[model samples]
Target: MSDIEIRPARFESPEVQKVVAEALADLSQRYGGSGDDTPVTMSDFDPPDGAFFVAVRDGTLVGSGGWRRHGSDAELKRMFTTPAARGLGVARRMLATIEESARVAGCGRMILETGYLQPEAIALYESAGYRRIADFGHYAGEDGVRSYARDL
Candidate 1:
């Protein structure tokens, strides 16, 4: 994992878009849909208000995630690790990076929305100390959707 480097990235950068497309493809396969329908914009991941990141291993982008201000809390978004990087702690490192950045930006907590179809993601969040929280976001009240939160 020492070869993996996590760093801030522009949401619109080509490398970030590549990883995001891969992630959405994975989600589309998992849910048999066009992928997540939540609205997002490049400015949502801009610094000061929020931050986006990528995990690069040997110069290849292996993972991506970001956090955006949601009131006093930071909402985690787009966390994903390529199949080839699964179990390599790439997502974990990215999660830690996002959390720290949100904290430094004055967020009091971190929150996220995921689906039950993603057991690996649920496990990761639970193990990272995230607890079930009231449903929020576009997926709120939707079947199979789950939300979690952790104090920063």
Candidate 2:
């Protein structure tokens, strides 16, 4: 949409928290994730570090994605697109945007952990050149999350 804008979400910003919570709530509903965990949780990309972003269309946000460097590799977190905004290339654009950020930040590679329940998410990553990789970060311990990676 012409009004759609992709911008960084200030880590502690209220709007960022709202959108992220809504998105995670959606994911939790779809999968069995209780999502009781706070949506505003931290990572390498929060506030003093890391990055977050959102895609707003016609005043309503439709998608978001963010990444943070871990050693030399960038770890992507909080990537989500609302169903109402899917099939319009939103996810692909967000992925490219964040990957661009990674490249610009001097990262050599990028990695992410998605889930089996999210076929669309996995497909989007694969389409954007991310290949299946070992589970990473928060997903490292959980048996649920499936991870993927790609060179910048």
lDDT by residue (60-141, candidate 1, tens digit) is 9999999999999999999999999999999899999999999999999999999999999999999999999999999999
**Once superposed on the true structure, which residue ranges of model 2 sit more than 4 Å away at CA?**
36-43, 46-49
Q: Clash totals for all models, in order?
A: 0, 1
Candidate-wise lDDT, in order: 0.95, 0.77
lDDT of 1 at 114: 96
Least accurate 10 contiguous residues by lDDT in model 1: 29-38
Candidate 1 has a TM-score of 0.98
RMSD of 2: 2.5
**For model 2, how does the per-residue alpha-carbon lDDT over 46-71 read when each residue is reduced to its tens digit?**
64346788999988778888887678
Question: For candidate 1, what is the lDDT?
Answer: 0.95
